[model samples]
Target: MCSGFPALFFAVAYNNPRDSWSQVVPIRLRLLRERFVVFFGKGSYGRDTLINTLGVLFAAVIPVAVLPILSRLYSPAEFGLFGVFAALVGLGTIASTGRYEAAILLPEEDDAAVSIACAAFLFLTAFVSALAIIFTLAYFIGVGSVRAHSALIGLGVIAVAFSGCVQILLSAAIRKRVFAKVSFARFCAALVSAFLSILLGASTQYAEGLAIGVTAGYAVCALILSRVVARQYGGVSLPDRAAIYGQVKRYRNFPLFSLPSDFSNTLATNLPVLFFSTFFGSAATGYLTMFQRIWAGTSIMVTGLGETFRQRAATERQQTGNFNRTMRVTLLPLVLLSVVLCATLVLLGPKLFEVVAGVEWREAGVYGQILAPFVCLQFVASPVSWSFYIAERLKLLAVWQLALLVSFSLSLFVGSKLFSAQGTLAVLSCVGVVLYAIYILISERISREENKVS
Candidate 1:
């Protein structure tokens, strides 16, 4: 019965609430009569709770469940070294041949998606090799140090990046409403990664175990993901490079200039650990990293909200060439979730941290309480920028880049000088709010113009 609500919703939603209740009764009867077989059979699996829980499961496992156990198994110094390596790996990844994989599902069909995904895998693989050669040389030549040996770290990064390609396909599968297959791939990865982490921890200490588990797990995950993708999509062809490039060029407005802003955002958000290691000890950085993860957990809300909005906005735009409803839906949740998340993180993060993270990170509780609110604000503010992506306003996105530059620079300098470790959180939060406010005004103005045009 509840499974039919989403499809039946339009009958009621398209009219005034007072009048729509009468229509809903008839619509409900009609839906059950005609669509009962579909709804009860497959649609039951696509219920809201099932969809949401799947998302939350991945969000929880990726950062918290897996990483925490790995963290405890390893030393802070080793972890910090790994963090630095991850920072570098993550940096180049954003531009891995221009995120060719993500170009899929943009109004583009599965074939376009396939090309982008395949091209992205090949591109990122080559990109990884180049980076490995460059970094490995630097490590040996006294230029830089990548912990856990460059070969292992390089392998893990490549595997993880490839897994990213698989995850994208899984996400595309979910978007296409294939819940059972998505569930299979997700749990398989989760179980394998979790077990691998424990086994690896039994022998290798610190970053080494974490790195191996990640690399080996990626190998398994990628294989499972490919099988599931093949089952769902059936058959593939060599991607049309020209056609793929055409698609990329068509959406050139999407992430091109905004790409740097995205990268900077990641850096500004996580670079604190680098600063932490430099200023404080490795242990101090580790204490704070757990809080960073908790804050990331709070961001799951933002991700969900954005996902819902993107779908709504796309539907609206196709039908009406504007996004008024999207703005309302997206912004309302952004504000409401921001408040709830910020308050909850501020209030409950301490107790929650202690229970979840154990005694080694008792200090992380205070860190979570202080940092979590800041992160909540940042996460809430973040999705507002997506409107620019949807509206083809990368120039406006670039404007925020300048704002981000100023904010990040000021935060880094001022926060480092004053609050030391604590100040980074405050500074980064402030910077995020400033940028979000700019995005809000710009988004509102664009919507107003769109309305005027209509």
Candidate 2:
């Protein structure tokens, strides 16, 4: 029968009331269905979050589903190279827009928002051009990794540009409340990247193929989201020079404070891969990369929820001048999710890796077990920490990010000297737990103080 058959049957039974069983069962089922519909209906936070989460789920699953095949097709050292290349691209992408994209949702005026987007694009162009120049010089001088893998220089530049564009366009989409489009864009990117990676791996079996797939995926995502933003915003236009400069000045704090904060945070997060590659060797870096990929798969839901939370919290702050209630509601579910994730990883991490990605990846699973608590806490803290942005506490946020960088670097250094790769990860995880806990506490306090002021 059709998809609506069960609903129709229940409705008819409820109306007819042939017996007590039919009457009570239909009524309860109908009520449950109605509740479900309402809870995820249009314009509801639940609906937006569900859309984003499902999108992220599909995106995350694609790469994860190919891991078994990819593991067999490529060597650990090749994966390690891909991991480092990704880290560099990530760092560049974070700086590309000069943090202007983060302010896209903060402005009240559509014109102002458009101007900020235009400014972000301008920054992105300059940043990418400079990156290309640097990469060219590095290739000529045979400096660092770029000299060894000249192809990566071009791939890095392309990935950074596309990734930066995706970030800017995504902010515009979020502001316009076109969550489904955002979700679709993400899924498309992931699908394209995963498919290309597998296809290229089978034929080329080169690390460059992996990076090529990722860059192509970002290009696709950027193209899709650019169209979505164009339709939603009635085509993005560059404001007059005066208008663009005005918006830039108005949101100067974003570049000044948010840029550094974001850069530091990204650097801290990606430093371990570089460290592993440098000190522990490529195989170790590969294992760590695998663990991070698995962690990323689990955390995509949190990332999606956080996107919705940021938009909702921003709206609430604009209306009520505080988002304490929204923050609290978001926090509880995240904590519960964290608990479940931690328990699962601690118990089944290595075994799960062995079964899914082959015996060679068991080491990565051990890394997962060691880092589970830290990542779980991170899953909780990252969303709540948006309070720093909401409350205009950019300076404080920058300080905290710097502290995280220092602490993380120190932990990695000390742990590496004193212990094995697993030991170093353990130490890093411990430091992360403490820092993330402090972050959550401070975010709560910020929300409370904003409430009191409001």
Candidate 3:
């Protein structure tokens, strides 16, 4: 009879849906805060999250502030080339680490953790070096064209190695709770890169300048963060080959399953640029790239939020063997935020883009509106998807990525056959939103299972 009171209350509340939600949400939030304290202790997750979010906010703001000036300095052709270069870097960076850097947080022993870091760094160096050789040979043999792609090929490999190095170091910092240092590094990188791109674009009048600026920023950021990581583990001995080999073997699932999953994910996102360049032209690719940049600026915020959540989630999983509370608290707010933002974009995106980016960019704004739903889902999903790794469910993640790749391919083929670039983006967005929804459900199920086990 007493238990029935709660059900009766909810039943009555639902008679007024809007009022019910408003009442229920605050109750949920209060419960969630209490649960967070139970899982993570007081002030830990909140403080670290604030620090991380501030860093991402600074990083995101700097580039966006300069975009107007950059758009004027660089032509669409240059931006298109810049997009291609970025795509390659994205694909290669994931491959470089072989996805083993994820294990840096799993080990309780500093020695074991350091070994995993070294293994990831070694793999990254070897992978990027091999890529450099391939590109250099291609250039020398006159296949990829030294004049057209040489600058990117030369810079791309370096960026991948440096970026991979930074990732390993940052992961170490995160594991150790050095949030402030990590955040500051992010801000500095964005600030330096934006100005460098502006100065270089104005002077050199080419896409290579943008590429160079980005790579240099990563290198500088990596250098600074490496110092923080080094000081944190100042006395720890470097991992020997045997230690690294064992670490690699121990975390083989990461490379075997996580690597393929990550590679597919990266390829799926970046393939549009290559395909568009082949089918539509550089101008179309340029427009798509501009939309992507705007989306990226927004994503950085979510990414920041996710990174902090991941650090906490990893700890929670290690201690509690489940992430049910974390999932419940995190997913609801983000989903709500995404829905609201996407709706707003769908309404005002075109005019906002035309006004801020210039009249020539109005079409890009229209594309932005078409793509908002997908971006919203991505913004929410990308960060939380790390839970799959935290939960050691890389096999499921791999399967999902394969399905995503297939869906994207079909969308591209159908869109190309049926309509134009606009139609293609529209089709992709619809398909993407559906897939992301499924992914969230799968992740939620995993969380529930963990809760049951706990």
- Evaluated with TM-score, which candidate comes out highest? 2
**Model 1: pairs clashing at backbone N, Cα or C within 3 Å:** 74-206
Off by over 4 Å in 2: 1-45, 235-237, 307-333, 390-392, 447-454
Point out the higher-scoring one by lDDT: 2 or 3: 2
Least accurate stretch of 10 residues (summed lDDT) in model 2?
A: 445-454
RMSD of each: 6.3, 5.8, 7.6
Model 3, CA-based lDDT: 0.83
**Candidate 3: tens digits of C-alpha lDDT, residues 1-454:** 4344376458648787668867666766777778788655634767677777888788888888888888888877788888888998888888899888889999999999999998998898789879878887888788845647787778988889888988898899999888888989988998889989999988986988889889988998899899999999988999888998999899998888778877898999998887777677777888889889987887776766687678877777767877777888888889899988898789988787777777777777888899999989887887788777777676678888999999998898888778899999999999999999899888777765553321
Give per-residue lDDT, candidate 3, residue 320: 85
- Give the alpha carbon lDDT tens digit for every residue of 1-454 in model 2: 4335566565666777577466656667888889888978788778878887888788889998888999877778888989999999999999999999999999898889999999999999999999889878878887876767888768989999999999999999999888899989988999899889999999988889899999999999999998998898885566898988998999998888778888999999999998999889988999899889877877777776677778888878878878877889999999988999999999999999899888988888899999999999998987777788778787788889999999999999998899999999999999999999999989877876643322
Evaluate residue 378 in candidate 2 and report its C-alpha lDDT on the 0 to 100 scale: 92
Tens digit of per-residue lDDT, candidate 1, span 1-454: 4456765666566766677778878878887766755544555532643565565567355656665566567766666655655555566556554555555666547777776666556666776667667767777776444543665566556755655566456555654666656666666665776677677776777565655555665566567767777776676565677966766667564356546666676666557777777776677777776666566665665665565666666567667877777777677767776777777767876676666766666666766666654565566656655667667776666666666666777776677778766666667666766666666777766654452211
**What is the TM-score of each predicted model, taking all chains together?**
0.76, 0.85, 0.84
